[model samples]
Target: MKRSKLKWYGAKSELIELTKALIENGNLKGKQEDIFNEIQEVFNIELNNIDQAITKFNTRNQENETKFLDTLKNTLSKYIKSKLEKNR
Candidate 1:
């Protein structure tokens, strides 16, 4: 059977929370480009470059992460968690 794209309830909110947490923890410093690359690499999403990645993320209003995309999200989330822990 074919699988459908994952439908999340509060993906956008979660993204916001994740962003805020990363910022508050200063985990967002010096890794902007690497973060964008991680998103593309983990999601198999092709973005032109770091700026495009930032633009895409900034332009999104409210969006849900599909199954494959969720994999990317989780990967990033783990990265943030690790960073937060490491810095503490």
Candidate 2:
């Protein structure tokens, strides 16, 4: 899909605030529809900027996911090894 060009002035700032809100809230507490509506309300004017922000957010999210999984795997491996040694 073709991305709309971002509106520079207030749009970028609004998008930044929206991004921060999402990150801080993480699992936004509300009905899915309401949450979506809120997002739409915020980004409706600056749809293009929203697209750009989403792309960046997705990239960061993937990186964070990889780091989290790696940490979890290492922790589990150590825990399993300790248990096995104790059982032996």
Candidate 3:
């Protein structure tokens, strides 16, 4: 099947974190670079210097390190709550 190329405009760190999480959780197989290449092909985005980006993400202050993941959690929580309320 042909895949459409969707551009990713978010921070590279966020994408890197997500990629690592997928691998760590056993949701995806292969090395980081391989996964990154797949993502790039699928999304038509360029992800360069992944190792360096990950290093920067790790060194960030506690509050900023997982900002994107935290945002996702909060957004999903709100969506679930809204759905539950609507079902009442």
Could you say which candidate leads in TM-score? 3
> Which whole-number lDDT from 0 to 100 does residue 87 have in model 2?
100
Could you give candidate 3's per-residue lDDT for residues 1-88 as a string of tens digits?
6875687788777888888778879999987778899988877778888889888877989998877888999999999999999999
In model 3, the number of clashes is 0
Q: Put the candidates in lDDT order, highest first.
A: 3, 2, 1
Residues 13-75 of candidate 1 have per-residue lDDT tens digits of: 344334434644897765655665454454444445444443455565555323334666799
Q: Write the per-residue lDDT of candidate 2 for residues 1-88, one digit (tens) a residue.
A: 4444543344453445454455457857665446644555554542445445545655766556334335657889999999999999
Sort the candidates on TM-score, descending order.
3, 2, 1
Each prediction's TM-score versus the true structure: 0.28, 0.31, 0.84
Superposition error at 5 for model 1 (Å) = 12
Best-fitting candidate, scored by lDDT:
3
> What lDDT does the true structure give each of the candidates?
0.53, 0.54, 0.83
lDDT of 2: 0.54
The Cα RMSD of model 3 versus the native structure comes to 1.8
What are the clashing pairs of model 3?
none
- Which is the winner by TM-score between candidate 2 and candidate 3? 3
